[model samples]
Target: MKLRQKAYALAALLYLEFSNRTRRSSLAEKVWEDSSAEQAMTNLRQTLLHTRDVESRHGFRLFEADATEIELNRDLTIDLREIGRIRAATDAADLATLIDLYRGELLAGVDGLGSEFGQWLSLERTRIENQFAIQATEAALRFGGRTGHAALHKLAERLPYSDTVCRATIELLRAEGNEAGARAAYAAFRNRLRHGLGLEPAAETAELIEQEGAAPVGAQPRTPARRSTDIQPDDTIRPSFVPRVVLLPPLQDFKQASIPRHLAPALVEDVTIGLSRLKSVSVIAPHTAWQLDPFSALDEVRSHQIDYAVESRIAPNFTGDGLSLAIRLVRAAGREIVWADKFAFSALSAQERYWDFTNGVARALADSIETAELQRERTQRDANAYSHYLAGRHNLRTFDLPKIRRGRKSLRIAREIEPEQASIESALARSYVVEWVLRAGSDRALLDKAKLHAERAVSIDPNDGTAYRELGRVALFDRDLDLSLAHMSMAADLAPNHADVLADFADTLVHNSDFNSAQEKIDAAIRLNPVPPDEYLWTLGGINFFRGRWEEALRHLSQMRNPEPAFRLMAAAAAMAGQMDLARRYRLQALKLQPDFTTSRWVSRMPQRDPADVDLYIEALRKAGFK
Candidate 1:
């Protein structure tokens, strides 16, 4: 099929899948953007020509009888069209069929299509891939030695790079007392890695193969010991002993690249950090939860012997401002969703706009974990602070001077209402930091205020890592490298697996000229929460800039829309590495964005870890055309 035709089919399929049949005009607007009716019709024709027909009128057809309207075949078997039905099906056969239909790219070699569709396609692909991987692994583990071999083999073939699938295959072989087969499978995997990617098998794989070989033929295969599920009967065990709650890692609807794979772990950590602040609740460490899979809520609850479990999923809010999170609380014994809701919040900025949706979810989960009437009290207080904070956060995303001023105004209101609330204070301090960093503000003054706010927040509740994190930001702005590092380090230690804290810490390290360490930290943060904030990419660009990898720096920095001064700095560095004209353009942009931006001001703003590194940036920016 021609590329143009395929693009049309894919577009039509996407429209039919996402939109109502009656909204053809809306679909055309979305798919074709500003293209005229004639052009859209032509594309639709080309798409129909490329699509294969399964039956008469039910194939991939595009119709536009009315100039203003467009429509697709109602009976098309597009992969996306089948996904929902397949996913909802209780029958394994239907799922397998749907899985088989998902082959290669949704629309290969199609560009000029907007990023929104492309992002959606990417997320859908990831979700399907993860689903296939998980189901395949579960099947292999459950019935590998019985009726699951053929299915397992097919899954392994499709997802050859999945360590989960490989491990499951080995487990299946070992379970059937086929040690030799398992060894052979390991050898094959090792050879495939070496030959295909020029890389050796990971240590875990090597260890597993070696351990398998040493085990006796008749001996039972050893697995890690499961946590004790003993529930003692005593007055201490109240009917609602939901005090101990384990937040299982969230599930990602991997429909966008920004959605981090490590988000599950990070989210779990975030909830853990938030819940730990409550003196009444005993939140489980992410490591202690053991079960990371969102699908295994029931199994985890029973195994971990927890009274309640909180599960969450992160998806982009169609509203275009920030992230939307869905959170649910389930009673361990009954496997019922005791509470479920969706919360939306914009990304964090230097100024306040609104409350964090994820924090709201955490707050709700906290309420659920508490016993009876206390739940109401905790919920009301947390709900009020959370709503105000989210509003402040949304305003902060704008990053303009007026927006920052407005955001600060909102934050002041939040702080007034929840004077002792750590989340509220931390959020408000963050807004001030944003103003200091992005707009015109005294770094020292902002840092001093931020320090006081953050310190007060921590004093209110030392266990709350968010407050410590705000303090770390203040330290960074103050050019106190050691203090910044110490505070961020403490935040990470408190919430070892939280993504936001890790990303922020990585940013601090990059600012301090710890390039290699920053890269590792960023990589780890990405792994913990695959979808990092745009600022994380900006931080990466800074790291690359300091390392003199201009091209790599440009790659990271370009991901951001409407370049900030720091981004312009990286762009200038990239241009300096190659084209002088490009360097001049970026440098001018940087100056325009910050008319008051000078080498002295820039140096003063930075938390100088080393006098020499400070000198280096000062010199580089001057050379790149900064005033």
Candidate 2:
């Protein structure tokens, strides 16, 4: 039967006590421990209602509850109860049956629950593993030959840290006249123990491989030795598992009467199907995703072993002519956003536009997952290509001149290790772009290098939107406006849900004198990322300055945490708005950061469709005390 929250309640009733019963207050407190006492009681009632619904569908109830207590239906056959009955068996057949019935750890990935559930689950898992190890080892010793070897091997895999299981497997292999297999198993286990757990196997485990007869069967399992607090668990080292993602049902808060409610859910279904096509990640089925609460119940979501979650919300844009959909890809571990963007479409857009929207969501989701996977691959440090790439990518985003150079060095090392890697090449190109801009467009060599690396990245992987985005920036700096527009348009088409790409495209549009379109694009980008990077704000400030909204320009620029990059522009905006004191302060800050500042050099490097715009900027800068 398909059970949800009620499953945990059933497990507690079945296994927590010998009577298969619990006080209603106690059960509520355990399962809904994070909620208030009154709320917990309410939740308990709702959970039991859910159980009744399941029972109606399946023809029988698993739970019997009263006003004061909840109990498992005594007549129902439960697998866990059956397992509990035979947990202490000594017979080889009974123990073998128990081993076969036992699955891996209980509630395997369900963590971050309430404290009471977390404690109970941990103790329960330990109890099961401990009992299963003893019984399996005993079973393997009693049932000799190939069957015995198989039993011990299964036990070893289930409890890799168990020295007793390892010794048993090694001896069983030797007794079967497979000394080579025995030695190989010993070597593998020893390496895992030393490297993975950072400790050596017991002396008895080592002696089995050197001499031989048997490693002394029927020995009790060893309690794990204490280790440094910094050591991570086994799952952290195993990066080979495929990442699982769930596309949650979108939150549709449409105030517009014309916008249909079905549109958001339809988009979610389309994106889910698109994500399922990618083999690198596994997509949770739509039925399951729909049943999950996207905003709340994250602990229950993580219980399904979801590595990432794609959450979306749909609403009408400020302009009533269109609908806006915001999408965010979040890492389940830390609940950090890996990527997020907003897409705007007309209420009655073409079917192809919807297809384009879903495609962009899928592509960006895949790219973000790849980057997050790289960041998680920190176990091997410098030797791992992923580590180098992550370091370069992280530093490159800082937008500092020296850090950009350092980022370049790391990305170059990553490229050497994985020659023809498109991600590294794209990042290398971005580093050059940042360095070129940071140097105030004086470094022509940086643009050429950026173009070269971007082209190589495109050649290596034409689908990479980041490569096209970098190439667009290079062309913009090179004064090739037409080429820059084409490349930027292509980048946006390829990754429509990429906020940075949209913001960059908007910046290019501002230089091309498309102020209205640029404003719309920047607004959408900001909506995609509620807490935007300083660069996005800087771009918005520039767009406003060019559009002659000096007050708006100053307002946007003032929001930047580090306004040093745009201090001169801020000064100009402030002066034009008649805030002479603020303007002079900003000018002093700019000169403090760059004493050699001159309006002539800055205006000459500035890109604008009309020379008049540059003249006006220079005029404002002069008023703000710039030489």
Candidate 3:
């Protein structure tokens, strides 16, 4: 049987017709982000040609396009036109008709419509749900029972976290003496709410069940305010723009107990608290977890609008090594385990072991979350400043000037939106350092500005290691080796596993004549991030230079992203190895980047401790033709 296929076609149709005029390039890029501009243009042409064919073959006139622009045919009828008109009407009959017109979400059953399209769909889907919810609620109240109750049920499910609808539905069910049915509806709503936000039913909803005095044992009401362990409903009606993370109950099995099971809630709490501290993430409470049925958790996660989930389990090791705690972090869209680790500890007190394990996992989680969420931010079409901040950080990893400037703007926008966010301040500080060192080395004012944000980042949250790392970089650029190492060391202690922190510390170590330790830390940084940033390569090259491995130094520096620094190092390394021709070639490259560079001035600015080594560096650069 032939199945219907309309999503991509409709998406193309709508995009061409939405604004009444669109560039074919813009449309293609929106519809196919993975495709090249040339490919996108070709596909756009083919699709427009195909739409024209459909008109001739099936007698449907969707739209038409020219080389650079597309405009919908004036006579063609659009479904959205009808939806918009019906939406504005005040009559119930029109609302019902509008509701019926939404058979499903726009561009449904579509795949790979690019991030821009996905964003449009997300906003449109949200708009549709909100409008449908209001109308559905009103109709449910007006129609009364059977159909009204059914409409209420539909609205309740659509908005699983809504307390008002659930309470109303329960009351209506109770009024009809359908106590069993009422109980079933409340359970489903509670399950959905718990599954979505890890929140319990509101106090009012809970009282509805107990008022009858026939409440089940599991449905017992809480007499006091919310405890730390309990999940609370969101203050917002819908999920916010930040990446929403949910922590599920930690156990070896749902049907079977793991380590007596009582310790599960505390462990989940640890994860939730750790994730909650990051300004970038929005964490669902552990209280909303632990109690929900494990089988139903996955289905409810989507309705909750969750991005990632943290789950852990403990079991005895097969090798008789006591037990292992296996914690996994997964993204909802792909269910991919972005990070996971298993820790083996002696069967000591659960509380003590939990703290020890969580400390390590929490730090690692912070690092891994940055990487995962950055990926998420890239794919988000309607991401907010937090998302912009993530994207900026990711781009800044390259340490290039154009990208750095772009990243700086993103971070500044993020800071403006969330002035109290320490992470954005840290990132903004680092970007300033990059811009100052690479683009405006003579600009003392930029250094001062960078220092302000670095200090502010620390003042805002003294524990944020990235803040200290940036402070160290600022000091390093200012040639204050002692202060640089001091801040960097503190950063290492605070964020021992963060790749950026370790890399920054390694840079400070190189300047302080601690090559061996620097190599160790930088290598560790590389192991933590297999694709270490370009700055890591620069640090590694510097280490080899001090170790007198000229060939190795040249090899490492040659692969650095920005060839200016790479070429400068290469010139010295080649001359030190007595390769006159290669030295001349590299020196020419370095001079091309900084024509004013001279051996006397460059050597004087060197951070090396030994006068003899400084003399050696000058001699090498002179051999390579630095004036």
Candidate 4:
């Protein structure tokens, strides 16, 4: 029932900690850091054998280790992975299970394997503790009333030194009118802080306590406790401080009794899911939104340190036959409505409109939040990383060569500040792709760098769709059309709600000559992003060009404010349409941007599903006077 050897325990723990396959060399290096490579390999093999023996004796297979790699049995039920359940749980019983599952610190009595193992264990322990505290506090806050109070109290007892846990416990007690209980919780926390760490309760925590008058029982410190200036005022312990937003449940307008009862909640849920898929913003859970008090929403926003609030109201439109959904994006700092929009739709219409509404609201709110963040003051270095990221994204959207370079510089700084950020890595990958494409694939090194960043992004977070899309683009440039299609398809599957992912997928599909499917994908993307970006327009134009709709291609291409990247394609499309004057003009523009651009060389770099498509493109380009 127990692993007698520390090495056996370490072997099993390594497999349990990381769900992915573990290389034998990596396992050896981590467990036997002081040993020679050969000795470490011998040690790892012995450890794995011992662990296997223990598992077999218990009549269970914990892992399978081959000559080169080891992987935990996917079907084996491990209590440690239950940490994931804690974050996903919304009910009291499920929330309480976290308390049971996390009996104590991970690998409680196991010790002193190696420096590598020790460092890894130390980081894992801290991560577990922080994750447990944050998840418990969020669960307690979301499920209010007696159940929530009990959960918070248990959380506070479990992690007494965690300021976030203690604050949540106090806040819940105060909200429930338990003044004495609130004061006692605050007093105990304050005393624990002073005694354990020679620190005091944070200003915000003490302010909550002060509002309830002096502690009734504990003796106050002789010298007033000063707040620590180093930590941010709210939830600084959270790993990622991305802009937090809450989409409040839509309020019903009784004046519109004809509106469907389910429509408003459905819209909110759609928008919530859409926004959650995006890396730009972190959304408050829909359950939390449903339970939030709209009357004192500002107070809730302040309590949660939320950056933006999405409030909606459903009412009868001017025609009375359709329902009007009014959405407003409010900046939490000043409580000002920065953006607002209203969508009118009939109940009989297809649910595609529902997605349209979701996409429009989510995209606009994310952009508005980014704009607000750029103008706001950054209080910490971590905050600066986000500012640089936003600025980088803004510059990249301009589609100008100099601006794109500036964007890469900003992204590099952001990546330097936060090396583990998948979004930053993904953006860097995109910047490289843009540069590679802008230069007409003249520099293969840019594609290599893009691939590296994209690989890193996916490695950091496999669920990041943009990373996959960038990886797919790199594959396309490498002339691996099938691999490009696979990665792009995965990206779309991973982020179905992301307009950018869909647009990118459509663009890749065009190269595969799936014209109808590509058009459908791009159309859906444009639906989601009604005011489409230049990339979306270029994708649409490309699809049209391949479909032999030359005039349509030109129409979309001309709409791009900076159409330099699409100039060659525009010239080809115009020439194919027999517009000789317009084709020459566009060809001149393309040459102005890249004087060395040649049809034969450029066509060689392009990926296509059929060689005939390549021939067609070359013919059109040559006809347009592109040598």
Q: In candidate 1, what are the lDDT values of residues 1-627, reduced to their tens digit?
A: 355445454554445455625344445544554467668556655544444342234543443234454455465555656754543544456545655665654464555655444544433344445555665457446544444566566665766655456667777888888888887777776566545543444334455766745732212211112323221111122233234567776555445435335433433453465555453445555544543455544444443335457766665565574566666665443233556667652232201211242344345554545424333323235444444554565566556768777767766887787787776677677777877876455545876787788888788767667778888888776667888899999887765555567779998988777877888777655543333456767777777777778777777676666566564567457555766677777777777776776677656556656577666667666667776
Pairs in steric clash, model 4: none
**Where is the poorest 10-residue window by lDDT in model 2?**
229-238
**Model 3 quality (TM-score):** 0.44
TM for every model, in the order presented, reads 0.51, 0.46, 0.44, 0.43
- Model 1: lDDT equals 0.58
Output the TM-score of candidate 4: 0.43
Clashing pairs in 3: 198-288, 231-287, 231-288
Give the winner by TM-score: 3 or 4: 3
Q: Which of candidates 1 and 4 reaches a greater TM-score?
A: 1
CA-lDDT, candidates in order: 0.58, 0.67, 0.62, 0.70
lDDT of 3 by residue, 1-627 (tens): 011233244444454335666666756665665678899777667666655666788786665666677666667655555555642555545555555555655656665555444544543454444455544555556566676576565555455565557666777777788888778888887777565555566545666876886764555331112335211222232222345566676555322224434344444553454344454455554434544444344434544445556666665564564566666665443333556667763323443444444444344445576645433322212225545565566566555789888878877887777787776788788888888878636677787888899899899778777788888878887888888888998887766546557777887888788888998787656533433456777888788887889988777777755667678778888988889899999888778778887776765556665566677677767777777
Alpha-carbon lDDT of model 3: 0.62
Model 3 misplaced stretches (Cα beyond 4 Å): 1-388
Q: Alpha carbon lDDT of residue 333, candidate 4?
A: 34
Best-performing candidate as measured by lDDT = 4
